[model samples]
Target: MVRRRFPVLLLHIFSMFAGTAGNTQEILYPFGPEHRDLETPKMDDGSSAEITLSISFVYFNIPYRTVYVNNNGVISFNVQVSQFTPEAFPLSDSRSFIAPLWADVHNGIRGDVYYRESTEPELLEKATQDVRKYFKNMPAFTATWVFITTWHQVTFYGGSQTTPVRFKCILLLNLA
Candidate 1:
């Protein structure tokens, strides 16, 4: 019954030291969020107009997918109609002449869709065709018509993984 607790205490300390020596320490490098600084482009100081239309189609290849699509885009139509008319009216004239004028078409990317593997190209083709058809039926105009189509590829955290998607934007402008 003599003091025998000294040996037990020493053994506990030695075991803890041995355990720590064999374990490996890991070093972690944490990253902060990324920032993008962009400047706004100079826009024309004129009135803005917009026209929206709905497109519907049935794809036999992908019957289960959506059949109705809403195609929309921005319209920039800035032209002087009074100058081309027989009588040039003053700017103060409240009664403006309405005639077919020039139109500048600009297409913008709207939304993103993630599709299954090997289906992106087919889906994109189908969507593009449908958009073209919708615009072809628009009323004829006199000025140059620009059609802008935007496609975006977004990656999270700048990683290699990407979601396959297609977006079609159509802008139709008619002046009377």
Candidate 2:
């Protein structure tokens, strides 16, 4: 018997991101050559090693200085997320999971996943502006730390390698 694969529809990936203890807003940050500083190794349902952030960020009153980004589109704090499918919100577990678009991503077959933490003045300034625009109530908001991850031209677990999706997730911290 011949097999046919159907496209898996996912929630608007860009609108999904995890943040510190507060209201989370969607910010469109540039994911260009300047931001692609590091890359996740090629693998199926794999994740980057626990990456330490430049600044400590708190979630649920807990501060985490380290995090990891998985090929399946999960930026986790406190632990590595091996789960490929996205679980319903208000997760059953206590681990901080940021599901950008958790999928059975097989990057080993095709594509590149990049992540980096930034404190560069220029980048920070841009992030600050973006946040301020969204949080008009906090007109003086300035983003001092940011974690950016992008799945550039990444293919699905069994989809055609030629067709891919490009998306990014950005987490910002403004302790001031």
Each candidate's lDDT (Cα)?
Answer: 0.21, 0.70
TM-score top scorer: 2
* Residue-level lDDT tens digits of model 2 in 1-176: 65221111112243122223132223335564665668888988888988987666666566778988889888898888878877788888787867877788778877788888778898778777766666678686667677778786687888666656666777777765
User: Which residue runs does candidate 2 get wrong by more than 4 Å?
Assistant: 1-36
TM-score of 1: 0.19
Flag clash pairs in model 2. Answer: none
Each candidate's clash count:
1, 0
TM-scores of the models, in the order given: 0.19, 0.78
